[model samples]
Structure formats: C-alpha cells, structure tokens
Target chain A: MKKVLNLILFLGFTFWCFAQDHVNSENRIANRHCLDCHGQRVYSFVNPDDGSTVRKLMPVDFRVDSALFYTGAHHIFKCVDCHVPEYDSFPHPNQLRFEPMYACLDCHGGDDTYAKYHFETIDEQFQKSVHSPETLNGFTCWNCHDPHSFRINQRTGESIANTIAYDNAVCMKCHFETGSEVMLLLANEKLKPMSVSHDWLPNQELHFRQVRCIECHAAMHDSLLVAHLVSPADSAVKQCKECHSRNTMLLSSWYRFQNIENRNKNGFVNGVLLNEAYVIGASRNEILNILSLILFGLTLGGILVHALFRLKMNKRKRHE
Target chain B: MSEKLYLYPLWLRLWHGLNALFFLTLLVTGISMQYSDIDFPLVRFDLAVTGHNIAGIGITLSYFMFITGNLFTSNGRQYRINIRSLFSDLLAQGRYYLFGIFSKQIPPFPVTLKSKFNPLQRVSYIGAMYVLFPIVAITGWALLFPETIARQAFGYSGTLLTALLHIVMGFFMSIFMIVHVYMCTVGKTPLSNFKSMINGYHEAH
Candidate 1:
C-alpha cells in the first residue's frame, strides 16, 4: 500500500508540471495565431456613395517588424500579456481597435515593483517635462520609443562614451535626421531648427560626439535622473562663457551627481564652488576680486595725484 | 656733489629687462587667448595660445635665473624681511609716501648696498615672486594637462581650483606691475630710476 501511494504521488507531480508547460506553450500558440493574421491582413474600404477608395491599417504599416520584435526587450512577453485576455480570441473582433484594447498603465501604474523595474515615474515626471502641452496633449512614451522595440540601456557596465552615445541616439532619431516625417506630424512648428553652423563653438564635433545635448539644454539640478525638462533652442545655453566659467552649468548634472559628497561639503556659498576651475565673474571668491580692484584703483589714483602735485611744487621751486 | 651709485648689476639689469618683456608678452597673449572669439585681436586664437605658452616658458626661465643669481649674490638680501619690523616699517613707508615725501623729508629706509628695497618693496616682491609666480605657473600648466586636473582626487576639482588660483594670481601681478612702474618714477628724477635699470647707475645722496 505504501509503494502504491508513493507511485500515485509521483504521477500527480508529473501531471502538474506538464500542465504548467502546456499553459506557457498555449500563450505562445495564441500569440502566433494573432500575428499570422496581423502579419498578412490589409483591410481596405471603398465608399460607394462618393465612389472613393481608402486604405486603412495596411499589413506593411500595422504588422510588427518581426526582426525587431524577436530581439526586442519585450520579446519575453506574449501578445496577450499586454493586449489583455480580450485579445486571446482568434482573428480578434472585426471592429477591434488596438488603442482602446490595451493601455500601458495596466501593469505599470500603482505598483512600486513595476516602477522600479521600468525606471519610470510615469505621470509624475512626464507632466512637468518640456513636451507637455498647455492642453491635455503631449507625447506618450511610444512617440519616442516604440513599445515593441524599446530596450533598456545597460548603463551599469557600459563605458561613459557608449552610454552617452545610446542616450543621444534617441534624440538624434528625430533631430539628427534631416526632414524627419514623424517630426513634422508630432513636433509641427515647435521643432527647433538644427544649428548647422557651429561657428562660435570650438571643437564642435568633439563636443557633439561626447556630451549629451541634455547636459547643457536641461534645467540645472544635483541629480540628472530627475532633470528631464529640456529648454527650447532659443533659451538653451549657447554661450561658451556659461560652461567655461568657474560656476558652470555642466556641474549641475553628471559631474555634480558623481561628486555629490564633495558638492554637499563645499556647497554653493556664493554661487561658486571653491575647489573647481574658477571662472572670472563666475565662481571665484567675489569679495577678494572687489577688494583687489578697489585697492588697485586707489593706489594708481594716489600715485597719479602725487606725481602731479610734486611736478607743480618743483616748477614753483625752480622759478623762485 | 651728487653721488651716482652703481646699484643694478649687469645680471640684475638683464634679468629685470627680460622679466618685464616676457611678463608683458604673457599678459597680452593671455588676454588674446581669453577673448579669442571676441572682436579684439592682438593675435589669432591659435597663435595667441602658442605665444602665451612660449612667453610662459620664457618667464619661467627668467624667474629661475633671477632666483639662481640672487642665491649666489647679495641681491637676495634685499628681499629678506625682518618680521619684527615689517609692520612698523610698512607704516613708516606709507607715512612717507603720504606726507613726508611731499614735504621733502629724507626717506627713512634708503636704498644702499645691503638694502635695495624699502620694507614695502621687500614684502611685495616676496609675495609676488614666491606666492604669485608659483601659483600662476602651476595653474597654467594644470589647464594644459586637463586630464590630470579633471579627476576629483581631493574634495574639489583640481582643474577648477588651479584655474581660480591662476586668475587671482594674475590679477595681483597686474596690480604689482602698475605700482612698480609708478614707484620707479618716485626716484630723485623721474627718468633717473628708468635710466638706472638700463645703465646700472642710480642717483644717490
């Protein structure tokens, strides 16, 4: 009886393991079913009343770029996971729209674990970002980063040069490319004209290659992680003196974050850092400069007056 | 008889002349480099950098010559400060410049074989040579090798700190030059001190 009971227990365990595998395999099969139609179908319509032809959601446009999707950070997820249980059905509903079918906040909002995993504060930061419009209109994450192909930057082990490249690439997708069609639709008149002539800047190529555009363009702060508010091109820092100065805006980001302890200790006493390259009229001790200037003016003035007085006295003496 | 003293030796005269020339050159080139983008143009940006670096080297060499020559001769004694009498001597010198000099009173501290500088001159010279020159040179070199100063070793950025020190020192140097030229005119004859620097002869009582 003991041997029979042990054999039965082992069988039950095997069945449970098989069930778990079946469920995972089922998700994959369901995703493939949805992709098969989405990959090939191009829904077309003709208006009989106006005798007009229209095309909507062509397979070329609607279909996921399989090559990108397979290798993307989201590749681990099946279609149903984000599309929800409503999308598990075959051929989807005839009048189904993907926009109302799924929302990004379903899993992302309200949970600490998801927030940490995503490195996203969602609405808290996005609302205050430069892109936020006066009305309830602005860019979603999908505008810049495609949901199907979004990848997390591996900043921890990457070299500084590589990290900078990765971050800038996102902006350059629109900014660097000449006559970006997507930019026209999204940014419209708000797009800042690219500075084609960098005549004022020295080593322009070196600066563009190494530094992120956000470094100078963003608002000043101790932590770069939260300073996402980008200034418009007109208001952006174009002056060399700003960075070249002792109290540079460059110190507000990466350098500041890296040297947090030192910054905290020295502090910005007079809008100047004591232990950094001092900029004239920027970061150096202002009191010392003022005192020295006063002394210089007084001494030089005194010398001139004394010389004039002596010359007048000498003339009087010589005449007598 | 108006006695003429052979005060400035040949080496001292040569060192002084070279120091003045190189310092003026450095000042001009530095300003050019600093505001290279601006409308003012004493030299082209690249040329200004080259000239500044060359002038800096020349100043460094002249400075070393002055130090070596002074170490081997009595000229070094002129800069030696008597800490005890420094404040009082400075006050007396200040008073003379303010009142006594105009009234035709004899200078309390006169230039002689042992004492070429008054108390004020000795203090200013020491500060300029030992404190200012070293700082300017070191900081200027720090900017040249940005990688070395870029890293934060201590609590602050070495590059920035060095730059600040360099600018401040340069300011003091400018003031020193202005005052030194003016004080040179305070000799028995305005041209006498200028002639002494060139020909090694000064008017003496």
Candidate 2:
C-alpha cells in the first residue's frame, strides 16, 4: 500500500506540474497569438464571424499586426530582426537574435548611442534588478526589452532614438517564461510590486506591476549646448533645463534664470535623474509593508503569549 | 432611578448595530486584505479582499445612515457632549472601571433620554464618525478604484500615495478593533451590549 501510494503521489506531482502550464490563458493547445511564428495566416482570429480565437498557441506572434500597432511610426519595420532565424522556420533557435525577450538584448546592444553619454551605468543595476534572481532571471540591459520604437516614449528631447516599447507591452510579453499563456496571468500577479505570496493573478487592477525599474531609471543621455554663443544665440539650455532644472539652477551662478548667456545643454545628471525620485515614490507602500510586518509580528506574539500564559495560570489555579 | 424614564429610539439602535457589524467586518477583512497571507486570513485571500472592499463600502454607507438617522431624529442628542463636563465624565468612567465597578456600584455617568452615551463614548463616536471614518472611506475608495485616480491626476504618481493611505488607515482600524472589543465587554453584562446589538434592547437588571 505504501509503495503504491508513493508511486501514485509521484505521478500526481508530475501531472500537477504539467497541468499548471496549461491552466493559463495563452497556453491552450490552440490560441491566436501563436500564429506569428506558425506562419499560418488564418490562425489568430479563427472563424471571424463566430468570433472564436484559434491557431495553435505557438510562440508569441511578435510581428502579427494588432489594432494599436499603427499608433506608432516604427510599426513599418519588417519581420527580419524580430522573427530572426525563425523568419523562415518554426522552431526558433534558443540563441537566435529573435529568441523571445532575450533576443531583444542581442539586437539592441547595451551601448547603442541614443545620445552622447547614453546611460551605460545601468549594467550593474540591471544585473541586480528586482525581477532578477527570484521569480525571473537576472536581466542584462537588453533582456527586459529592445529599444526599437519611441512611439511610446523618447527619453531624449530630440527625435533621434525611436527605440522603447510601451512599459505595459514590455512586461506582458516576458510575463510568462517557460510556461503557457494562462500561466502569464499568474506570473503577473506574482510580479506585483506588493505581491503577498498567496495572491495568484489578482484581477484587482493594473497599477500593481505597472511601475517597473526602467520606467524610472531610463537613460538620461547628455546632450551638447554652447554656453555663450557670440553670433547665433544658443537654444540648448532652454530645452535642457526642462529635465535638468535642479542641477542647472544650482550650477548657473552668474547666469540669470531667463538669460541666454549660460546654455546648459546637459541632460539629467546621474544624481539629478528622476529615476531615484520615482523609485522612492513607489517605495512608500513597500516601507508601509515593512512597518506592518513589524507591527503584526509584535501584536501576534503578544496575543499568543497573553493567551498561552493565561491558559497555564488557569490550570495552575484550578490545581491549587 | 425608577422615577426617571428614558426611551431609546429604534433608528439609533438599528444604525449603531449595523455600523458596529460593518465596522468589525471591515476591520477584520481590512487587516486580512493588507497583510494577506495563506497562514492567517479568516477567509480566502480573494474573498478577503472582496469582503474588505464590500465591508469598506458598507461602513461608508452605514456612517451616512447613522448620521442621517441622527440628523432626522431626536437621537442626535447623543452626540451633544458638553466641554465643561468632559473631564468629569472621563473621571467618573475611569474610576468606575478601575475601582467602583468591582464594588457593584452604579455607573459613573447616568443614561437619559437625550444623553445615552457618556462623554468619552460621545467623543469616540464623533471622532470615529467625522474624522477617521471619512478619511478611511476616501482613502479606501481611492485605492480601490486607482484607475480613476490615475485618470484624474493624468499622472500615475497617485497610485503609491493611495496605497500608502489604504495601509495606514488599515493600521488605525486594526488598533480601533482592540479598543472596540474591550469596550464591548465593559457593558452591563459581559454579553449584555453584545446581545443588545442583536435585539436592540438592554433592560436595567
């Protein structure tokens, strides 16, 4: 009986492990988003009249056009960069340039010049990212996403680097790693900034996981501006002052606030970046949680001690 | 004492009981929702959050009901705490709880048709109704429907601020629970007020 039970338990565990993968939204034997890699044109919106989703739930249809795809300019790019080797084949290579999220890093090398002093210092922070080493793997600068389209956001004031996906779009794609699409929802709930371990894919709201690290610590690449132009007036300081208000204000001693004399073309310095400020903004609840934990532990321990000791005293008094 | 007659109104009793029940539910479910863990929730995590949301809304509704009932009815007299008598009321109640209660003496403050609650009780109820409850209601509503706050602000900065408020208010409510429970037991009988809450009547035995 014991041997049979152990075998049954083993089989049950294995079955459960596999079952969890299929339990999620995107991992069914069929789902629409898989049609991108599958190459079959008729997969995603199967039976459009009946309005049912079809197609084998293959890898995410990275290039498959969606309604909002046309909202940005870079939507015209071809399938070569994204679909990579799989631009021709079904099973994409693990190390290919188009290999899911990691491939994003391969295409956009960490050192691409968006601006003169593009933030390369984020390498260490990316290694120790909150998404690193626990639920998900530690990320390289490129692992989180490719900086290809700035239709969502351009860190620079100049229209130069158009490479950065919308924040939500970036998170949702990599949300399910090594699991089916349905598991993606569970992954999302687990990824919440205020995840309470038991919260599994909460339908509560989106703000929970929306504020990722890059949303704050975006590269504040430096720019150039002639401080005191003689012939032609410099316009760099006017533009640069927007993001660099604190530092520019501090540095411009002799320069008037309205004077065109000192054109501070510098973008946000490392110290003046709103990344830390935005991060601290999110830290309020985290700090609250820490304080709550301390209070809860103390309250529970005191209550337990009070009850247990009271019980012991009652027993002793009854004996007396 | 037999010569003096005071009749408690029905709406006051109803509003008080509903307020107490909803407040208790909100407190338990609120704590459960905030520090939600598999180890100790009185209900499942999802259900706990739902209950907190519902109970929080219910408490807000109950507060409005209580105040409305008070305003429309003569039971509003219970809220009228005199500043001059405040210290005496507290001393009387404190002394009764400390020493006089064990001697089976009369309660320090007398209950009448107009003034049912002692000064301390009136102050506590006023603070709960006007100050803590409203702050909690606004904060809880904002946190619950953060998408609205996000839209209103046109910036996402308010989400963290709202969540912080929700947690802080939750802490206040949990501490209130300790005091509320202790006060409930200090009634005519240990179970007298608890039973009064159910039947809406307490006779002087």
Best by DockQ: 1
Clashes in model 1: which pairs? A246-A279, A276-B160, A276-B161, A277-B160, A277-B161
Provide the lowest-lDDT 10-residue window in model 2 chain A.
A224-233
- Extract clashing residue pairs from model 2: A24-A182, A24-A183, A25-A182, A26-A181, A26-A182, A27-A181, A147-A163, A148-A163, A149-A163, A150-A162
Question: After superposing candidate 1, which stretches have Cα over 4 Å from the reference?
Answer: A1-270, A274-292, B31-45, B153-155
Q: Residue by residue across B1-205, what tens digits does model 2's lDDT show? A: 3222334456766777777778778777655544443334455555666677888788788778888887887877778878987888788887775556545568867666556677677887787676777778897897676556642132223554555555676676665666566566655555766666666655453
User: TM for chain B in all models?
Assistant: 0.93, 0.79
Looking at model 1, residue A235 earns an lDDT score of 74
User: For model 2, what is the error of residue A225's alpha carbon versus the real structure, in angstroms, after optimal superposition?
Assistant: 32
Question: Per-prediction DockQ scores?
Answer: 0.16, 0.02
Across residues B14-109, which tens digit of lDDT does each residue of candidate 1 receive?
999999999998888765544443334556655566677888888989999999998998888877899998899999999998788776789999
Q: Per-residue CA lDDT of candidate 1, range A1-320, in tens?
A: 99999999999999999886674565456667666546444544466679686555644446675446655667667886676565655345765574453345665677786655443444444556666554225566565567676665532333345656767777777676364655666667434445563445654555675567777666754423434566655677776545544456656655454344444655655224443333322344556657877988898887789888888877877887
How accurately is candidate 2 docked according to DockQ? 0.02
lDDT (Cα, 0-100) at A128 in candidate 2? 41
